[model samples]
Target: MKISFLCILIAAIQPFLWAGAAKFGGQRSGTRYDNRAPRDTLAHLSGWPQRANWAQQNSFEAFPIFAAAVLMAYAAGVPAALIDFWAVCFIVARFAYFACYVANLATLRSLVWFAGVIACVRLMCAAI
Candidate 1:
């Protein structure tokens, strides 16, 4: 399988990492985990934990675009090497994005988010 396909798999699970961090961090804020109403529970968290929750949600939001780009690129016969490069770039940018979010580096996080978007766009362009 192409490395880009592997990236798709990794990206699929990336959001859970942030979600887990948010859960653990929220526990630090004395917020009990409410399995029945997790979003409400997370809403009560503050500081880094809250940011982590947002990061998790953003990761979820980003996944579909990235996944669709990869699938479209593959279907359109984009070269594996080029697709892989952009896919890796997107994954790295996402990791940086998540770190910046948790660190409360709003500017850096926004920049990283843009970088990830660019990577995804480039991957999609490769299909044309």
Candidate 2:
């Protein structure tokens, strides 16, 4: 697969990592991961775990526009190198965003989130 397409797969899978962190990361209060009531359990998480869950939700929220942008870039015949570059940018920014969220670095997270958005927008605009 092209790297950009692979990036889409990575993007799709990234949120699960944050979910796992929210459920399984250190700082839990004697409660096992409640797969049976995951959302409820996650909703009660605090500190970094809570932040991880938020990151997971944000990651899910971010995926569609990014995926559409990449596909649009492909359909519009954007250069493969440029597509790959922007996709990589998005992935890197997202990873940073996740870290910042978990670390409670709100300002840095917002900046990285903007970076990811810019990457997606660049991809979509390249098609236009």
Candidate 3:
């Protein structure tokens, strides 16, 4: 499979990773995960768990655009190396953004978000 295609899978899965962390990462702190009422559980989370939930939400928001960009680039006959490079950079930036969000590094998270956006924009431009 093309690396860009693989990145779509990774990007899809990334939000679940954050969701898992948000649900389970705070279990030891006396907040049991409410599987039946997951949204309620997430709503009460604070600190890292809360931030993890935010990260998960943002990941979901970002995925469609990234995936569309990759598909568009492939459809437009953009070079594999270029597509793969931006896709990988997007993945790396998202991971960094997640870490920064959980750690409360607001400024750094914004910078990383810009990097991810740039990757998606590059892919879109290449497709054009």
| All candidates: TM-score | 0.95, 0.95, 0.97
Q: Mind sharing the TM-score for model 1?
A: 0.95
* Candidate number achieving the greatest TM-score relative to the actual structure: 3
| Preferred candidate (lDDT higher): 1 or 2 | 2
Separately for all candidates shown, the number of backbone clashes (residues 3 or more apart, or on different chains) is 0, 0, 0
lDDT of 1 by residue, 1-128 (tens): 37888899889898898889999998987888899999899888898999998989999999999999998898898888888899999999999999999999999999999999999999888887
Give me the runs in candidate 2 sitting further than 4 Å from their true place. none
Each model's lDDT: 0.91, 0.93, 0.94
What TM-score does candidate 2 get on C-alpha atoms?
0.95
What does candidate 3's lDDT look like per residue over 18-95, in tens digits? Answer: 999998876855678988999998988988989999999999999999999999999999999999999999999999
What shift in Å separates residue 99 of candidate 1 from its native position after superposition?
0.2
Look at candidate 1 and tell me the lDDT of residue 15. 85
Candidate 3 matches the true fold with a TM-score of 0.97
The predicted structure with the larger TM-score, 1 or 3, is 3
